[model samples]
Target: MHSTMERWSGRVAVVTGASAGIGAAIAHELVKKGLKVVGLARRVEKVEELSSSLKSEKGKMYAVKCDVTKESHVTLAFKWVKENLGGVDILVNNAGVAIDSSLIDGSTEDLKKMLDLNILALSVCTKEALKSMKERGVDDGHIININSVAGHIPPQDYFCMYAATKHAITILTEGLRRELVARDSNIRVTSISPGLVKTDLPPKVVLQVSPYLNPEDIAGSVVYVLDTPPHVQIHELTILPVRQRL
Candidate 1:
């Protein structure tokens, strides 16, 4: 039997950095699939615009102003979800950045920003989401981390620290899975790694290749993963442009 999103209809989902690019696309797709979505981003107006545009979709969208690098912001965001939406059944940790710095000669501030947003922020969001899931007995809750192909490969010039942070995500995803298994919880954790997506996150000067993947492509992968059977778990999924040699 094929998997379907019927089980997740009307459920609540928290998507970080949902203002634009991959996060926006994922939020849009999830709303259309009938899941009530809360979009968290620093650019609150952008998310509000998206929510407004998606007014007639099968589900609803709420905009929350958030800077994921701040733990307090993430905490408040989840608290709001708990109070207003009961709890979150899904969390897409898509807030990430690729700095214009290198490991060898990178500014400490730049490296810290990458680490704080990509790794620390994701961990905190997972912790909050898991707490919400546990409190409400949501065994089928899913945590989808928006990772990058750089996580699985060596650093490439300017992406040195960014790659290091993504590598942390790869390990963190597995670590969370192990902890869930130890507790015998049915909650699922997934990492979706895409290569060279056409997004503002990556610097344009470094994109010297043709045929980059689009934000919608990653969004489609997220939908596919979420629609899988309850018995299925897609731990790691890597997507790349067909002709691009990584």
Candidate 2:
């Protein structure tokens, strides 16, 4: 086993949006590293299906039906983790959405949903995880936020608000890091930015890119960041496929 991974064996991790795509990939990767994982998503049956099939892996995986946008659900989800699986050693904030709507003519409901899931939900999960880590004195816990290339550049192809939400994640990652520094804490925070990943995105959104990255590519980055020694924090990771210009 990898040296860093060896230390995480039997530890607890919470991965949001784990029903499918990059979120599901990250959950699977971590469980393979021997970390007990709780996969949270609105459509948790998918996670349950994946979990049942992962019985032979080094560590175990479970599902939590959580709608991250709701504060009550987020709180209840973390509460269940505390009461059941124990303190969290790692948190992967991977729930997000992208739509094929321009800000100029987009439905307000669509824009609000983007903000709720991408920004508000991520923040809530981070807060809940930090609360558990602090209460448990978990010095080496980590918080990983899944960002995007859209976060670092101007919006394109009618994803302006979605890009804006990712930009918020970019700043949020830094802000959380600074807070930890001020508190003299060892907990690590990372933001992973990947470009043009091929997943279940709408065809309109998918048509704009070529040679896209696979979800596993992003999941691999999550493992790399988590597999680092405690003193090493990957503050921001931006991955773009060779042929992807954006």
**What's the lDDT for all of these models?**
0.93, 0.91
Output the worst ten-in-a-row residue range by lDDT, candidate 1: 202-211
- Kindly report which residue stretches of model 2 are placed more than 4 angstroms away from their true locations once superposed: 202-209
TM-score of each: 0.97, 0.96
Q: Write model 2 residue lDDT over 196-226, tens digit each, in one string.
A: 8878874744546476888999989998887
Question: Model 2: which residue pairs collide?
Answer: none
Model 1, 147: alpha-carbon shift in Å? Answer: 0.7
| Residue 1 accuracy (lDDT) in model 1 | 57
Model 1 CA lDDT for position 226: 92
